[model samples]
Structure formats: C-alpha cells, structure tokens
Target: MTTHRRLVLALQPDMLAICRLEPTAYIGNDVLNGNFVAITKTDEELSIICPQENMPEEAIYTKGWRCLRIEGPFSHDTSGILASVLAPLAEAHLSVFTATTFDTGHVLVKEENLNRAIQILTQTGHVVRSENKATVPYAIQ
Candidate 1:
C-alpha cells in the first residue's frame, strides 16, 4: 500500500542566481557573502548559488530562480522525504535545482515555473503557502 505523508511548503520571496566556473576557479569574498552562497566543485565544474544581486558582474550564470522551502527541522533519520516531493515534480515535467541545509531542503524552480510548481504540489496533497502565513502541522499518514 502507498502511504501519503503531509508536507508543508512555503515559497520564498528572494530571487536566487546560479553561476558556473571552471573546476579550479577561486571565488572572492564578496560572492561568498551573499544571503545564500553555495559552491561545489566536481571533476567537471564548480557551481554556485547565491542571492541574485550578489553575483559578480563577470560571472556566467542563470538567474531568476524562485525558492520553495520545505518546512522542516526534519530528523536525521527521515527517509524518502525528498524522493516523495521530487517524484511528483518529475512526473509533471518540471525541473528543479535543489539545495539542502541541515534543517530543511530548498528547491529552486525557474520563476516562470513557480506557479505551475505550486499547482502541482497542491494537487498532490502538499500544502503550498507563502512564507509569511501561519503553518499548520503536517502529519505523515
């Protein structure tokens, strides 16, 4: 039997920018000071995400991303939560860029895709709301 879990997601107001650099590229202090800054280096590329305005003028990036935050202080043992959320978006042909903090997961969908994403989430039984609204408790059923 398939079990449904209740999840509450809030749309964040800030616009996020993402940049890509060469594998060995070094980022300066300014970019690191963004409201949200992330850097990842793999064998092929170094990718970064930060508040849009903080992105260096010279950096090559794709901007205009809106964040949908999953309300969580989720325990370390929580499993399949991301999969549960991502599966529906994937099925709807929506693409997402995901970032995880210690306490929660932030999924960034292009600004144009935000509304469609919210509709899909709500249709799937997840509560989608703005960050400022009061949140109700989510239960895993």
Candidate 2:
C-alpha cells in the first residue's frame, strides 16, 4: 500500500455561498470584493463561490458553507494531494465541493458538517488550523 503524507489545511473564516448564474450573466463587484472568491464559467452556467454576505441579489444559491484550504505551493505535477484528503471524507459519507487553483485545493463542506468534517480529517492524520486562530479541535461558530 502506498502511504500518503498527512496534509495541513486552513479553515477560512468566512461563511460562504455557492451560486449559479446564467452562462452569459455578468459578474458584479459584490462577489469580487470578498476575501475569498472563485468564479467558474462553463457553457451551461457561471458558478460563483463567495462570502455569503457578498452574493449578488439575482443569484440562485446555496448558503452556509465553510472552506478548508489545503496548504500548498505544490508543483504542477504533484499527484494525489486532493484525492488523499477527499478519500477519507468520502468514506465518512461527508459531502464536499472542491475547487483548485494554481497552487492548491479548496474543499467546502456545509456549515452543519464543519465540526464533523474537521474531526474526520484530524482523525485520519491531517492537521486543520483556522485562519482566525481558533485552536485545534475547531469550535467554529
């Protein structure tokens, strides 16, 4: 069996919303102003993940998400990083939505599952720290 190294993830301090807009819809300043935002445009729709309080008025969204950022400046050829983290969560039956940037991966789990998710990750040997400096064994509000 191949052993994977434990990952360190940082929990962002903002409540987020995932929104879907028409593919042609214009993105506004509200989303751009968030401390963390991700916008993806596909032929079928435009998906936006941003701070819940900054979502556009016309968005069709699901609220109450918390983000976990996998610490990295991993090389482009790095493999299995995301899978290693996600596999354990999947085995625990936790639902997650993920996004990747040039440097790292981000996982978003609904607010109701945040504590359980953190527990599962830590139990699996990964370290989770909060951006707001909350101690380990996270007690996020």
Which candidate wins on TM-score?
2
Model 2 TM-score (2 dp): 0.93
Model 1 misplaced stretches (Cα beyond 4 Å): 1-3, 32-35, 134-141
As for model 1, its CA RMSD to the true structure in angstroms is 5.1
Q: Candidate 2 regions off by >4 Å?
A: 1-3, 132-135
Which 10 residues in a row give candidate 1 its minimum summed lDDT? 132-141
Tens digit of per-residue lDDT, candidate 2, span 14-119: 8999999999998778688765799999999999999999987889999999899998989999888988888888988999999999999999999999999998
lDDT of 1 by residue, 4-100 (tens): 6768888776688989888888777777764457777899988889888777676789999978788898997998667767888898899899988
At residue 93, what lDDT does model 1 achieve? 90
- RMSD each, Å: 5.1, 1.7
lDDT of 1 at 139: 22
